[model samples]
Target: MRRKRAAGEPQWFFRRLVAIGVIGFAAWRLMMLESAPDTRVNETIAWGWILLMATVVLGYLGFASAQDIVAIFATRSGTPYAALDDPTDPPERPSEPPRNFAG
Candidate 1:
C-alpha cells in the first residue's frame, strides 16, 4: 500500500499561521494604545495594518476557492449524475460471501 501525502505539507500551513499571528499582534497593539490615556496612536499606521490584514485574508480565500473549483472540474469528464445512470456499466456488488443465518 502507498502512503498518502498530506495536502499543503508546510508552505500554506506556515503562511496561514504567520498571518494569524501578525493580525493578532496588530489588534493587541491597537487596543493597548486606545486604552492608554497619554498615548496617541498613528492613524495611517493603524489603517495600513487593517488593510494589509484584509488583503491577506481575502487573497487566501480566493485562491482556496479557485483550487477547489478547478479540482472538481478536472476530476470528471461528464456530470456526476450521468455517471450513475449510464446503461452500459455493470451494477456494483459486494465481494463478501453469503453468511449462513439459520440458527
Candidate 2:
C-alpha cells in the first residue's frame, strides 16, 4: 500500500521528477552524439553539460547563502529574551558584606 504524502511532498516529488527528466534527456542527447563524426559537436555537448551542472551548483549555493542572510537578519531584528530577567524569579543577594582579605 502506498502511504499518503505530506503537505509539500507533491511539490518535492514534482521537482525531483523534473530534475530526473532533464538529466536523463541530457544523457540521452550526449549518447546520441557519440556516433557523430564531428569532434566539435561532442566537445560542445560536454562543455554544455559541465556548464549546466556548474550553474545548478552555484544557484543552490546562492540560494542557501541568501537564506542564511535572511535568517541572520531575522534573528537580529528580534528582541533578545534571554537578556531579560523574569520578575517571578528574583535574583538572590548576599546578606552579609564582604570581609577584608587580611582578616
Candidate 3:
C-alpha cells in the first residue's frame, strides 16, 4: 500500500511560519531601535499608537467571531429568531435560479 502525506501539513506549516515571522520581525525591529544613534520620542509614540490600533482591530475581529458563534448557537439551540435575524428590507430578486439547469 502507498503511504499518503498528512492532510494538514501545508496549513500547519504555513501557520507556524507566519507565527515565527511575526515574532522574528518584531525582535529584529526592537534590536535595530536599540542601536539607533538618534531616537525620536515621536517614533516611540507612533509605535504605541500602532499597538492601540492593532488592539482595536483585534477587538473588532473578536466581536465578529463572537457574532458568528452566536449565530451558530442560535441555529442549534432554538428557533433562531432575533432582532439580528430580522431583515431590514425585502431581499432583491434573484439574478437567476440558484441552481443551474444545464448541469
Worst 10 residues of 1 by lDDT: 77-86
TM-score each candidate.
Answer: 0.48, 0.44, 0.34
Global Cα lDDT for candidate 1: 0.65
**Candidate lDDT values, in order:** 0.65, 0.61, 0.57
Q: Which stretches of candidate 3 lie over 4 Å from their true place?
A: 1-40, 77-103
Whole-structure CA lDDT of model 3:
0.57
Q: On residues 1-103, what C-alpha lDDT tens digit does candidate 2 reach at each position?
A: 9655432222345545655666677777778777877787678887797677557556655765666566557667343222444499678886998777985
Candidate with maximal lDDT: 1
lDDT of 3 at 89: 90
Clashes of 1: 0
* Cα distance off (Å), candidate 2, residue 33: 2.4
Off by over 4 Å in 2: 1-21, 77-103
lDDT of 3 by residue, 22-68 (tens): 55666566666666665577478548655755665576557656665
Evaluate residue 51 in candidate 1 and report its C-alpha lDDT on the 0 to 100 scale. 86
Q: In candidate 3, which residue pairs clash?
A: none
Q: lDDT value for candidate 2? A: 0.61
